[model samples]
Every structure is written in C-alpha cells, then in structure tokens.
Target: MASTVADVAKMIDHSLLRPELTNEDVRAGCDLAARYAVASVCVKPCDVALAATRLDGTGVSTGTVIGFPHGSSSARIKAAEARTAVSDGARELDMVLNIGRLRGGDDEAVLDDIRAVVEAAPGTVVKVIFENAYLSDAEKIRACRLSEQAGVAYVKTSTGFAPGGATLADIRLMRANVSERVKVKAAGGVRTLDVLLEMSAAGAARFGATATAAILDDLSGRLARTGVATVRGDLSTDRRMGPDR
Candidate 1:
C-alpha cells in the first residue's frame, strides 16, 4: 500500500545520534520533534535524562541507544544500559545488535544478549539495530530471527555511523523476514520526502533522520502551491507553492 505524507510524518522517529551532540542540540532536536509531531527523538544514553526533562508532557518519547554504533559491548553492559535509560524516563530503546558475535557464528550468545535486554525492558519499546550496511544477506535474515525470538517491537536498519545505511532493498528484505508483529525502522540516510516514500513503499514503518526540517519544508511548499483545499494530493504541479513556503 502507498503511504501518504501524513502517514510518514506520524511514523518518523527523528534521530540525533552524534557522539558530540551537546545539550543545546538535544533541545533543538526535541523542539523540532514536538512541532513536527514525530514519533520520538532518539539520542544517546547520556542525554536521556535531560531530554526527558525538556520534553515533559509533549507526547514525544525520549529514546536512548545501547551498545551504540559499535556493538562490541558485553551483554552485561548492554543490559545495564537498558535498565538505566528506562529508569531515566526513556520510552524507547534502540539497541545495536552485537554484529561481532552474530557474524562470528555464536548465535546463542547474540540471542542471549538481545533477550537479556528485552527482559529488562517491561514497558519500553525495544528496536534492535541490525546495522544493515555491514551484514550479508544470510546474516541479515538470521539477525531478524533473533530479534523476533527476543520479542522486540522493531528491527532497525542502521546507526547512521556505518558506511551506508537504509537502502530500499535492505528495508524490503528485513520486512520480508519478520512477522507482522514486527516492523522495520530505516535510519542512516532517510533525508527527503521521495527517499522516505521510497522506503515506506518498501514496508518501513519508522524513519530515523537528521533532516526532518528540510523534508517537511518541501512538503509544506507543495501544499501551499496547490492550495490546501484542492491539494489533498498531487500538489507538485501547482505553481502557487512558491519557491519557499
């Protein structure tokens, strides 16, 4: 099924995953998230507490990363991080799947790691990042299985730190492997309306991006040109949209 802009807007989980992000950056990210009505604002574990304080009662969730861009952290450490972030008011956990262990053929170790974290999160939604850019086709399918068996809510494609992130092919493949109970979150390079629509068409239910403003700007422009009443769809052909909204 094709998705409308409204549907895509409601699905976005805007991301601020940089290691050097300051308090001000986190604030700006949260503010934009509120205005855009994005699903959540994803940040590092360290910023979860402050973000929660700033976004209080806005209906935007505070999300934290576990194991982060690199998934070499031990299972015990990842589990602790999940517990701490949840206690700090984060409603979502975007934990990195341990690529090393999974690729090394220790499936049990990898599944155990994800299961342990899932056990710690009772009300929190956990989306395990598969870092799709680094995985082979077989590894990708296997990792999706582990995510399902561990009872997570979503399978994420990237950390945005990898060489490449969230391709249409990858999103489709991940969606095919997981059941309807699970969904796919595409990150790393979701920067425009067309790019977003591409992934949404391929079955992505969530998007992680740093360029939400630009995309929304384009959408607004389209709406303005066609006159909101007549432009429910196909607003691009209208000239009234102006060069800038």
Candidate 2:
C-alpha cells in the first residue's frame, strides 16, 4: 500500500488537449485542476496563455503540446512552437517524436528533433511522447534511449490520439529502459483509479488523464470510507499487472 489522495492528485496532469475544447472549456479545466491541486493542466498550445492566467498562484503549472497527435512537424517548427509556448507562460511542454522517422530507423533525425525542442525551452519540463502503440519492443527501447540521451524530463506512453494508449506492459518496459533520472508518464486510457494504481506500480510516476475528476473522486470516496487509499502493486517487483488482483 502506498500514497495518499494528495500524492495521487499530484501525479496527474489534467488533459485539455482535445481539438473540440473551447476557451471556456479550457478555463473550466484549469479551474478543475486548481480545485484538485493536480500537478498541471496540459492544454492545447493556443490555450497556454489563458490557462496560465487562470492558474496563476494556484500552484498548478501550465503546459501545452507540440507537434501534437502527429509528430510530422519539422524540427525547426517544433522548436518555434516550444519557444512561443514558453513565452506564453507554459512551464511544461510535451512534444511528439517523429514516429515515421523512428520507424524508419532514422535515429539521428529523431534525436535531433527532440533536442531542438529541449534546446528551445531551456528550463521547462519537456516530456517526449513515444506514441508507443505503433512501435515494436525494440523500437520502444530505442525511443527510451533517445529520450534519455536528449535530456528530457519524462518519456510518455502515448498521445491519447493514437490507436491505442498506455498499457501496463509498456509502462514496465519504459521504466526498465530509462534511468532513474528519466521518469515515465502514462497517458491515454487511464480512466479509473485501479488503472492508475496499476500503472504506478508498473513504474509510472506521472499520468496524463482526461478522466481526472472521476478517478480522483473515486479515490476520495475510498479514502473517506477506509481512511486510506493505497496502491497495492509493489514497485520493487514490477510484476505483470493482472485484473487488479
């Protein structure tokens, strides 16, 4: 058993990256993040300023995505986006790596693409999204190596727009591949408290979730009932998570 509700709350980055979300929707998401005191609200690039202004002094960091669902943008373009986002007050930047390039084994291109954004934003927390659904295990390992080499803060599972999302197997693999300094962030399909716990046990330290309210609400209820909400999965074992035990 591990973690209080606050611990779980701090692990989540409330997602507001959907294309259909309006400015008002982003504002509401910011409010929700502030109320929950989550780690950050990852909004669309255009919403960075709005989210920053709304979340000011609330201790919830403002974040945005780059090259987004598709990692098709040029390295220079992605770097420009990163700089603009930082100027708009975004403290965190999540960038998608070039999936096609990675698949084609263009290691240098992939590494340079990630490095461009990291260089553009000097002090921000940059998370590299692998969009693992399309990668083989070997590819995943390579991606992790590249991310660590590029000096990223976190290596994420998916963009949530991909065909598949975070899985326990991928989380474990990513954690095993990266060094202690490089954290793993699970995103996409993390809709329940049990799922998050499973991922955490598998070695994910950060989570990107749109189902923030329900997951936290469920934990709050459990804590209220039992006076504690603890994760049962053991980090030491990193065992295969099955049916939540």
Candidate 3:
C-alpha cells in the first residue's frame, strides 16, 4: 500500500545548514520546528544551545553535526565534539562518517571511529551520514553495513554538500544492508514530491530538505505521524538552514 501524504511529510528534516546563518536564523528555525513539531532541529554545534533554548518547553529537541560535511577530524576530536554537542542540549547527532577512511579501505578505522563517537554521545540518536554521492555502490553498501555493526540509530545519505544527494537506489541499498534496528534517511536532492515519496517507499524513515514548502506545497492533508520540520500550515517564511549542509 502507498503511504499517506502526511506520512511522507513527517519524514522531512527541515534544513538550516548555511554557515553564514545568524543567531536570528537559528532562533527562527527552532521556532519553526517547535511550531510544526519537526523531527529534530539539526544545527551547528554552536547553535545547538540557541536551538535548545528556544524549544525547551516544546516537544522538539536539538540536533547537531559532528565531522560535518567533511568527516576528516580525528576520532578523538569528533568524539569531543559530540560530547560537547550533547551537553549543549543536542539530543541527536548527524555525525558524518570518516568517508575518506572508508574510501581508503581502512574499514576497521572507520568502525572504531564510529564507536568513539558513540561512546562520546551515548543515549543520543546517532544518524551516521555516508554522503552517498561521494561513494560507489560497493562503498555505499560497506558504509551502511559499518553503521549497522556500529549500532547507529540511522544511516543517512548525502550531507548535501557533495555534487549529488539522496537517490532511490541508494535508499534501497541502505535498507538492504542494515538490520531492522538501523533506519535509513534519504537526504540531498530530495525536493520534488515524487522523489520524496519514492524515498519513503524505498525505505527512508527520514528526509533532509531545504525546499520544504515545495514539498509541502505538493502535499495536501494531515499526516498520521509527527516530525520536526519547520514548515507550518498557513505560514510562508524562509527556513533556517539546519540539515542541508
């Protein structure tokens, strides 16, 4: 059976990933998330505090990145960043995998690195980003399996920084590799309703998008599930860059 439009909307991760964003941007983004009850406000580590402060009473929680668009930082540094983010009110972490290490064929190094971040930010949902556009089919499969072995909560596609973002084939690949415990998020290049719905049907439990209104524009009706998106009914304003980085 096909999913409802609401089901599709709940999967979106309303984005605010720009580096030039100001505190006002962060505040507006968090406010939107709270108003719409988005899945999580994925933000910069520094802005984690700002997002958290605004969404305190609301059910929404703050999310931050580690290793970010480029996951070159040492395991130690990444772990430290995760710890600080958690302490600063981040309930979720969109940590980028050390893609270079995975591509370099140092699979163990990558797993160990994920373990380190896991250790640093225990109890927080860890969505490991594979940046799918950068990897070949085999590398993507390998990364998904690694995220499973590491016991991450979600295996995400593109950081949205690379040339391409989420693709349906990639979402299926991710779903194929991981066990039931690990969920999949299809990010990047997911603007059109067709692409978003395709991803959801392919097994994406989450979506990261900057073109939220466009997605919502195509959608019509209430969703059964709630999410942390910044889009609200009868509202039209720019969104804070949260996860499209």
Candidate 4:
C-alpha cells in the first residue's frame, strides 16, 4: 500500500525519553511533534505536565513511562505513578513489565503489576512494554498473554534503554499471540520510514521514534515525487519539489 506523509506521521509517537534531555529539550520535542502532527509525544514522567501544556489543542497527545528502563518498581508505586501521570494530563502510559518476576514464573505477580496501573486510569490508553531484549521467545509469548489478560490497550516491544529494540519477528510474534483487541507498538531503533512501513505490515499500529523529523521529511519527498494526494483530514499541506531539490 502507498502511504502518504500523514500515514507515516500518525504511526510515530515522538520519543523524548532520553535521560539527559532538559526541560528545553522536552519543549522543543513537543514543538516538533506538533509541527508534524505526529500521534503523541512520549516524555519522561517529570516532563509530562510540560508536554501536556505545550501540546494542548495541537491534536497531539501527551504520554509518559512508568517503571521505565527497568520494571522493578513495586505494584503500589507503579499504580501511584500512573495516577499521578494521568492527573498531570497524560493521556497515554507506557509501562515496563517486571522482567524478573516474569522470568521467575511468577505470572500472577506480573499480571497484578500490570493490572494495578490499568486500574489506576480507567479510560486512558495503557501500553505494557515487554522489554523483549532480555526475554526468551516463550517469555515474550507469556508476556503478551499477560498483557492481554490485564486489558492493556497495547503491547510494546522495548524501553529504548535496553540492549535491543523492536524487531520485525518480535512484532509478528506478539501480534500473532495477542487478540485483535490488543494492539502492538514497536519502539526502540525504529528510525526510518521504511522500517515503520515494515512494522506496520507486521501488524504494528504504533511506533516510538526519536527520528521523527528525518522520517517525515523523507516521506514528504517521496510523496511529492509521486504526486500522491495527502491522506484524508491531515493538516500538512503538500510540498511539490522539483527534481533538483
């Protein structure tokens, strides 16, 4: 299928979760997401309020992580974090699952941990990050089942702080295991328009990316060359470039 610039833009959740980013960086990221009209801006917990305020009325959502990088936080703490994040205007929450507990075969503990956050925010979208880098194929499948059972909105691949990120194979596996109600989000190392298309073909509905600008720019150029009309109801105006740029 031929994807327009808007289709590619909506797939991206512009990631601003790097540890060293300052408030200024967060604001800049929010601006970029708004300019391109990407799906949302995923920021650090402390930056959620800032991002929400900046992105208000821009049609882009504000999202943050809970028990990020490592999913070792207690269930109570994670639940509290979820409540606080929602209160701070976050519409989406991407939380890491307790890898240790999952690996140790404590399925109930893992399921409860996910449910704690889901229960915290009733209507908000909750994505359970599996951190697939450290998990075996069996473990990954089990995590997908647990996420589905917990009633999360999406099953995410990684935190971007891990050794590896989303792979086409992992996404396909996750999609195959989860029910239609549970969507798949591919994060970490999804840097190009080609990769985004590949993931989408593999049944991924969303993506986490730090290279939103480059990907969108590339998509725009491609669309201009093909003279394809932009997708329905997208805000971006078409830019028809000559052969020489």
Candidate 5:
C-alpha cells in the first residue's frame, strides 16, 4: 500500500478523457493534476499539446488514449494515432487492444495490433487497457500474456466506459499472470481513498481516476487526524468509511 501522501498522489493518472469535456475542462484538469503533482493527465488526443504545454515544468506528464472505449481501429490507424499523439507531446499512451480479435482467439492479430502502437511511440509509456468487462477469465489471462509478449509497460483494467470496471480479483489475476516488469493499472469506480488503498494492496500500481481531488483530500484528512506520517492498509488503519456515515 502507498505509505505517504505523495506516494498515493503519484499513483493517480488524472483523467480528462470524458467525451463531453471541453477544452476549458481539459485545461482545468491539467491544472489540477499539476497542483496535486500527480503522475500525469490522461487527456483526449486533441488536448495532448495543450496539456503538455500547461503541465510543462510541473513534473506531471501528458498522456492520451488510442482506440479508446472500443478497440476496433485498424493497426495502421492506431499506429498513426500513436505517432501523432507523441508528436503532439504525449509521453504516455493508454491504448485499448482489439477486443474482438482477442475474444475471437486471434492471438497474432492482437499482438500485431498492440505492437503497432508500441513501436510507433518508441520510448513512450504504452498501457494496454483490456476492457475486461467484455472478456471472460480465460480471455483476460490470454490478454495478460499477449500484453507481456507485446512488451507494453502496463496492463490496465478498464477504460471507464465499460459496463464494469476494475475489481480486486482482476488485479490479482493480472499481477499473477504478468511478469514483474509489467505493472497493473485500475480504472473505473476507483473514486474513493479506501478503494484505492484496497486495490493497491491487491496488486495495482497505478490508477486512472476522475475523482482526484476527493480521493487525495480524504487521504490528507486521514493523515492529519491520525498523526501518522505513513499508512498501510493491511495494518488495520482506521476505517474512515463504514457501512453507514
């Protein structure tokens, strides 16, 4: 589990990928990320340059999504998108692998699809979102294996647009399946501090969250109240959240 405020702060990739968000919203989101000193702002593709510029010197990186909610785009298009995003100052790319192909048992196609993006952005952090809501356990395991084979940096749980999101079981499964080099990221429904701490303990190293301020604020409050310099979830730290508030 994260031990300090900064440890939890840095684990979040502040999300600005909502479809209806305007440029102003993206700018504000980037500003928030910078103020919080979070890991990065995962903005829309069009906002990559703007985020990069706004977040410049803030130590927060700029990231964008590819193939997004649905991973149906052709390899060529996804690769093109990756190259364009990188050129526009995106240092991280969260890409959805071709869900249909993976479900269809087309391993080679899946690998090629992922490789296209990874190779396109040479040094950028490439995270593969499985959209696990649509896949069975077998498919999820297969995706974990293929993602490892494709040499992606992180294997992510959801795109936050799916019917279901990250669960502890999936986090554990992913962590167990992938080698130690590949980290697990949990997105969707991780809007609270307790949930984030639970997922972190389960195995996730990163999170994609739109509720950045709330989560961090809760952590800061907990630290202040307990007078603890650091915290561990498994140590039975005060459960700020209960069945009833």
Candidate 6:
C-alpha cells in the first residue's frame, strides 16, 4: 500500500542528540516534533525530563540514548542510565550495543548488557543500536539475533556518529534475519523523504532523523501536488494519482 504523509510522519524519531545542542535547541526540536506529530523526540539523557514536559499532551513520546556514541560503558552503568531515563518520562530508549565485546566473540556478555537495560526499563520500548559501521555482516546478524533473544523492541542501524550511516543492504539483512516481532530502525543518513521511503520499503519501520522538518516538508509538497489528504485510507486521490505521484 502507498504510505501517506501521516504514515511517514509517524515513522520519524526526531533526533535531538547532538552533543553541542543546548536546552534551547532541544526545546525547538521538541516543538518541531510536536508540530509534525512525529513518533518521538529522541534527545540526550539529561534532556528527557524537559522533553517530556514540553511534549506533554503532544502525543509525541520522549526518548534518549544509553551508552550513547560509545557502547563501552559497563552493563551496570547502562542499566542505571535506562532506569533513570525511564523514570524521567522517557518512553523510548535507544541503546548502543557493546561493539568491542561483540567483536571479541563475547555474545553472552553482549546479551547480558542488553538484558540489563531491558530489565531496568521493564515496559519501556528499547531500540538496540548496532553501530553497523564497525561491525562485519556476520557480526551484524549475530547482534540482531541476540537483540531478538534479549527481547528488545527494535534493532537500529547506526548512531550517526559512525563513519557510515544506515545502508540498504544492512536494512535488508537485518529485516530478513530478525523475527516479525522485532522491528528495524534506520538511523543516520535518513535525511530526505525519498531515502526514508526507500528505507521503509527495505523494511525499516522507524527512522531517526535530524532532518525531520525538511523531509516532512518535502512529503507535504508531494502530497499537495497529488491532492492526497494526509489521513490514512481516505483514498480520495488513489485513483487520480499513482502511489509515487
């Protein structure tokens, strides 16, 4: 089925995780996310409370990262971070997997690391970031399997601090390997509506985008040209225009 503007908007996790971002930047990002009705505003750990406050009644969930750009933190520390973030009104948590441990073939340690956070956050949605830029294909698949076994909500592609970002091949591989219960999130490099749609077709159910405004603006323009209503299943223009038109 063709995805409408709302469909695309709901897939975005508006990223507010840049280290240099100030409180003002986070607030502006939250406003933008609310204005566009994005799925969530992914901010830094410290900004979760403020984001939640600003996003109250906005229907946009708040999210933050754990073990952030580097996944070298001990499992205990990551678990603590998750617990704190969840208590502060963060409904979603994006945590980086331990790349070094995984590379060292310590799958049990890696699984334990992920499980610790999941245990801490109980019902909170958790997206485990693979930071695929540093992992081999085999390692990536192993990470996905471990994440599924750990019962995480999603397996994400990149942290956007890596040398490379989410790629089509990686998305396809992750999608094919994981079970249906596990979703795929493509972060980094999802800067435009075209790329977002392409990733969606490749099996990315969610995207972490710093360019949420620009991409949604482009989608709005396209929908306007096609005269398609933003509401799902309206189908008023389904016959008048093709899905991509």
Maximum-TM-score candidate: 5
For each candidate, what TM-score against the reference? 0.90, 0.94, 0.86, 0.93, 0.96, 0.93
- How many clashes does the backbone of model 3 have? 13
Error of 3 at 27 (Å): 1.2
User: Could you give candidate 1's per-residue lDDT for residues 1-245 as a string of tens digits?
Assistant: 33345555678888887878899999989999888877888988889998898889888889989999888898899999999999999999999989988888889998998988899888789999999777899999999999999999999999999999999899989999999999999998888766776677688888898898887767666665555623233222233444322
Order of the predicted models by lDDT, top scorer first = 5, 2, 6, 4, 1, 3
lDDT of 2 by residue, 96-131 (tens): 999999999999999999999999999999999999
Would you list the C-alpha lDDT of every candidate in the order shown? Answer: 0.84, 0.91, 0.79, 0.90, 0.92, 0.91
Off by over 4 Å in 4: 230-245
Kindly state the number of residue pairs that clash in model 6. Answer: 0
Per-residue lDDT of candidate 6, residues 1-245 (tens digit): 66677778899999998889999999999999999999999999999999999999999999999999989999999999999999899999999999999999999999999999999999999999999999999999999999999999999999999999999999999999999999999998988776777788788999999999988887777678768656234222233333442
Question: 10-112, model 3: which lDDT tens digit per residue?
Answer: 6667777889999998898777766655576788888988888888988776888899889999999999999999899999898899988999999999998
Clashing pairs for predicted structure model 6, backbone only:
none
Using alpha carbons, what is the TM-score of model 6?
0.93
* Superposition error at 158 for model 4 (Å): 0.4
Could you tell me which 10 consecutive residues in candidate 1 have the lowest summed lDDT? 229-238
Error of 5 at 194 (Å): 0.5
lDDT of 4 by residue, 107-211 (tens): 999999999999999999999999999999999999999999999999999999999999989999999999999999999988876677667878899999999
Model 5 lDDT tens row, 1-245: 43788888999999999889998999899989999999999999989999999999999999999998799999999999999999999999999999999999999999999999999999999999999999999999999999999999999999999999999999999999999999999999998888888888888999999999988888787788877766765522357533211
Please name the candidate that would achieve the greatest lDDT relative to the true structure: 5
TM-score of model 4 (CA atoms): 0.93
Badly placed stretches (over 4 Å) of model 1 are 1-6, 228-245
List all candidate RMSDs to the true structure: 3.4, 3.1, 7.1, 4.2, 1.7, 3.3
